[model samples]
Target: MKPSDLDPVVDALEAELRPYRDSHHTYRRLPSGGRDRREILDEMRELASREEAKWRAGYSSGAVYHGSADHIEFLNEVYAVNSQSNPLHPELWPSAVKYEAEVVAMTATMLGGGEEGVPTVCGTVTSGGTESILLAMRTYRDRARAERGVAEPEIVVPVSAHAAFDKAAHYFGMRLVPVPVGADWRADVAAAEDAVTKQTVALVASAPGFPHGVIDPVEELSELARRKGIGCHVDGCLGGFVLPWAERLGYPVPPFDFRLPGVTSMSADTHKFGYAAKGSSVVLYRSSELRRYQYYKTATWMGGLYYSPTFAGSRPGAISAEAWAAMLAFGEEGYTIATKALLETAAVIRAGIERIPELRVLGDPLWVIAFASEEIDVYAVMDQMSARGWNLNGLQHPPAAHICVTLRHAQPGVAQRFVADLEASVADVRHMPGSQGVMAPIYGMTGAVKTRGTVEELLARYGDLQFKA
Candidate 1:
């Protein structure tokens, strides 16, 4: 599209992103006096009432992993009890220490750790999956510098890995080598082997990538890592909580954790499928010796002896408490049940997509489902799905769309409605003549924009519009 085409497309997006601007009061400056507590609560509640139903009724994809009212209320209670707690000062609140320690232990145990006389897997709780990935990458970089005397460190990551790996490479000033996946959308082991060099400190494989929902050949990748004497980090941020239960339920989940000799570290999100509240994740290392590199300490500081395990100095202990509480509430039995419902729902949705003559499923993904079509415009179909209140994700590269099936979709009638609405969406897009949706032109022009600076500028401008207040 021309520059003129992008302007109107951006204007429409700005309108949708700022829907609350006209309805609510914008606080550009402080008022002389504070508002009443009840009035503020009522106003926030009113907005939540208008917005909660989309995810509540399973119209969304992956935004709300476990949206049960009772679970949310339980997490809220846990957060409330530890609202004043901060993990930075363990002396002030010993319970915060226990919460974080147990959270890490439980997560590690779930992912092939916490056994007697094992390699002694240990880790620290981070803000989220992004921070976990960043911390692990930085730790490996620093470890290489100290132990191997390699000043210039690099990490080999699959192209289908999460964007956080790119962010980690940028922020840590390390080289990132992207290896393309095979036809099945999983990482190609031979290509990854070629990408590694003497300077390579770590290798990354996603346990079910974000875009295509295909797990890489981690067994082979980890074996390669073992031979090359480098660390292997499995990004289980998406499938960490669900895959173990899925395997127990008879899904063919490959080994992607510390059980393998080459697997040195991993990251998992408690906020996603662990049913915990947002803002909690675990990054585990094979041993406390390796994890020690991730910590920061300085006795010479004027601010007194300081040490922070993760990125943030004063972290929210309440979120860690919520994660711990959530894990205990949903033990093995609860997770197995939730996994059953979620997988069953996902199978239905995937089959429904396969039944559509125009659409083609990307891979043999278990939960997250991506489908594309050579017959019709996929973004147009996504637009129609959006019109029907179906919130799905749009993919690039091959131009596809996916839905991360969660407990939200396990609700009664949601799976059936999604299939019915998707069939209608494809039909509507098939009959429609020209590209005429908000995303249609945007995606079309973005795919055509080969200039990196132009694409960055366009995205930056769109993000700026989101903050117009």
Candidate 2:
């Protein structure tokens, strides 16, 4: 359905998204006179406190990766200390450079940099996973244009790859050729091989893709890229930090990093599983020469000679500092311990979902688990879960929902509680098949509508509503 056709639905959603409109003041304009500092602080605290319980109690998926109070307080203290510092002026705050360089080096080492058969994996810190992927794609596009004389570059991505690749293609003016996935939810290497053409500049793989949380065949895909003489970028934004420790703790993690000969670059998010605050990610390249393409320098500009790495010019050095502090605070031992708990909890949740006869898991995932019900509308089940305060990621094509297990979900009894609630949600869906909820009908309408532009318009309208005071 068109967005205008769903005005009532959007109105209902706006109420849920912006519930504080009734109780709190809407500030379309700044006050003529400044309010009391204490009053402002009290209002902010009240808003935060109201939303804290659901995530803290593991009712959400992937949003609050590490919500421990002490950890949060420590990060907040670190951010406050370096709040005014910006990486752009390195002379003023050389500590920002130190933090970012060390953050890159530490992340590189974790992802098999400076190891056997791998070139010096160097990279810059990006705002987040999307920025990281964008930079990587832009780097390949520029390099292909400069060296290979490829005027029109293309990227071969798995159907299950993150949408950031599509965003990268859109932003950087590159063609994205999508290949299908197999029954196991991993990328189809044969189809990827068939999709590669002379214009193809790079191939994309994912370490535990977001939808089904299954790693693509990086070994084979990267090998194909090597044979085809193209770059292979592994989207490890979701699983990079956790997988190394998971492999160390004896899990079945495939080789998806610089260890593979064909792997040219990678994107890993410190914010996701590294227990760092949001807004920081690392994009690594096989060598410095390839990474140099990602930099922007202008000596003939009206302003003084300047060079900026990554997309943003004056980035939050505080975020890099927080990422560095988070890594140091949670040393290898701490991360391993945390990954152990997360994977164990995920295993329990997976097994619980499997035991339910009505539903079946999409893949053999280690942490992020996706499940679908064959007997009932999975979206309705999602709404039922939402009614019980659970927030899950809804997927299309197969109509599934996933709960990305985080440190919060590893808390005592959270896994069991999730399983019980899930079973109850499935039962509710069975009892009332005709009853519809807010999100289910939206998903249903979006799927039924064949015109993609109409759905795009619907999403645009929702985005517009978010800014409606």
Q: Estimate each model's TM-score.
A: 0.97, 0.98
> What does candidate 2's lDDT look like per residue over 189-296, in tens digits?
999999999999999999989999999999999999999999999999999999999999999988989888899999999999988999999999999999999999
Compute the lDDT of residue 287 as modeled in candidate 1: 90
- Model 1 agreement with the true structure over 1-469: per-residue lDDT tens digits: 3555467667778877878777788888887799999999999999899999899999998989998889899999998999999988899999999989999898888988996324499898888999999999999999999999878899999998999999999999999999998889999999999999989999999998999899998899999999998999999999999998999999888887788889999999999999899999999999998999999999998999899998898989999999999999999999999999999999999999999999999988999999988998898888899899988888877888899999999988999999999999989888875554766646535444446665666688898886776
Which regions of candidate 1 deviate over 4 angstroms?
1-5, 116-119, 443-450
Q: Which ranges of candidate 2 are over 4 A from the true structure?
A: 1-3, 115-119, 444-450
Name every residue pair that clashes in candidate 2.
none
Poorest 10 consecutive residues by lDDT, candidate 1:
441-450
Candidates in order have lDDT scores of 0.89, 0.91
